[model samples]
Target chain A: DQQVKQNSPSLSVQEGRISILNCDYTNSMFDYFLWYKKYPAEGPTFLISISSIKDKNEDGRFTVFLNKSAKHLSLHIVPSQPGDSAVYFCAARAEGDSSYKLIFGSGTRLLVRP
Target chain B: NAGVTQTPKFRILKIGQSMTLQCTQDMNHNYMYWYRQDPGMGLKLIYYSVGAGITDKGEVPNGYNVSRSTTEDFPLRLELAAPSQTSVYFCASGAVSEQYFGPGTRLTVT
Candidate 1:
């Protein structure tokens, strides 16, 4: 079963606009969430993350909001740029697991039109 | 540092053939993992190692094997390859909550 799900396969937005990517999870045991961005033929790079205790975390133009009761999370990028076009993945880390293993979603491909 | 490195960027094998996928990390991280990504699907863990001489199975470990002989190396073995085994494989190493991944190995079984 897919514990983490990114229902949107792709998204498109205009430059300088807002880009929002959403993700949902079925496992309530997951206490930590992360986002990764990937380009074609390249490995994914860590973007940002939030703990279960925190509802929101922001870094520069990127922000992540978590709604624990809804089992949902979203990544928001304001004034999106062409460089932000890439596949984004949402992952979660389960509690009590020392392995630090992450369960990833299928990924959402974001396209920014300049 | 080299971070994480995987060998044989691409490979094709006939059914029933066997081969080993090599993974090495220079980060000196004690935790390493092997994962496979099918087309249009998310990554699924096959095995993980906490340290040398210790290994454990993950979500999908069938038809695959792994060994952690040293902190820097964790190799994945595929025995009796099948068509269903064709997928892209990735190796990752982490020291804490974050993991660094290699470019990945694309394998096909015909």
Candidate 2:
């Protein structure tokens, strides 16, 4: 069963515009959420994260919004740049879990057109 | 600093073959993990180690084994490889959050 899901397989956006990527989860036990960006043939790199206690977290041009009641989270990149094009993965970790393993989503490929 | 390095970036094995994927980290982090990504699928953890000499199974650990003999090395072993086991393996090290990942190793089992 896929606890975390990214419904959109791919997305395209024009440069200097906002790019939004959505993700949803079926497990309420998840408390920590993170977003990672991966380039072709490279490993996923951490972009930003938010604890369940906070609904929003921002870092430079990237911001993540979480809605616990809706079990949904969205990643927004303002003024998207061509360099930002990559596969974005959302991951979650459950609280009080000893193993500390992260459940990952299939990923959404984001393409920023110049 | 060679944060995380994986050897044999690509490999292919016939059924019943066995091999080890090597991973080493210079970050000196206590937490290490092994994850596999299949086509059009998200990554799944195969094993993880919180410290040297300690390891535990993750969501998919049936055909794999791991050993953490030192703080810098965490190697994953595949015994009697199967076609289903073919995928891209990644090694990461961190303290629990903000993991540093290696390039990855692509494996194919026929």
Candidate 3:
């Protein structure tokens, strides 16, 4: 079963515009969510994260919004730059006590057109 | 800290041949994982180890074997390589919330 899903396979946004990527999860047990960005030939790097307790978390130009009731989350990048072009993956963790197994989505390849 | 490191960034094997992919972490993390990614597909977990001497199978574990003799190293073995096993493999390490991934090893079976 696909616990996490990213319906959009690719996205394109003009540079200096906002880029939004969405993700959904079927498992309500997940409490922690994270977004990772990957460049060609490099490993994925953590971008931002949010806990179930908060609705939104922001770090500079990157912000993550979590809607627990909807079992959805999104990553927003303001003034998107060409350097931000890469594959973005959304992962969720359902911690059953101390054990938290991460479930990841297929990923969305974003292109910031200049 | 070189969070996670994988050896032989690229390799090619013939059908019926066998090989092992090496992975090491320097962060002293207790949790380690192996995942494979196919073209246009997300990563699928092959195996994972909570600590040395304790290993568990993940979503796709067939045609693969793993050993965790020491916390610093976790290696994956392919008994009889097949064309179907061609893909990019990733090794990750983490202690709690975040996972650090290696540069990935791309393998092809001819």
Candidate number of the best lDDT? 2
For model 1, what is the error of residue A67's alpha carbon versus the real structure, in angstroms, after optimal superposition?
0.2
Which CAPRI category fits model 1? medium
Q: Which stretches of candidate 3 lie over 4 Å from their true place?
A: none
Superior candidate under TM-score, 1 versus 2: 2
Worst 10 residues of 3 chain B by lDDT: B91-100
Better of 1 and 3 by TM-score: 1
Alpha-carbon interface RMSD for all candidates, in angstroms: 1.5, 1.1, 1.6
RMSD, model 3, all Cα superposed? 1.6
TM-score of each: 0.97, 0.98, 0.94
lDDT of 2 at A113: 98
Q: Model 3, DockQ value? A: 0.59
Compute DockQ for each candidate against the true complex: 0.63, 0.79, 0.59
For residues B1-110, what per-residue lDDT tens digits would candidate 1 score against the true structure?
A: 78999998999999999999999999989999998989888888899988999999888999999999999999999999999999999999884368888889999999
Write model 3 residue lDDT over A15-99, tens digit each, in one string. Answer: 9999999999999889899998989998888889999999999999999999988899999999899999999999888778525
lDDT of 2 by residue, B61-97 (tens): 9999999999999999999999999999999999556
Better of 2 and 3 by TM-score: 2
Poorest 10 consecutive residues of model 1 chain B by lDDT? B94-103
Global lDDT of each candidate: 0.92, 0.94, 0.91
Docking quality band of candidate 2, CAPRI definitions: medium
Candidate 2 residue lDDT tens string, A1-114: 999999999999999999999999999999889999999888899999988999999999999999999999999999899999999999999878643789999999999999
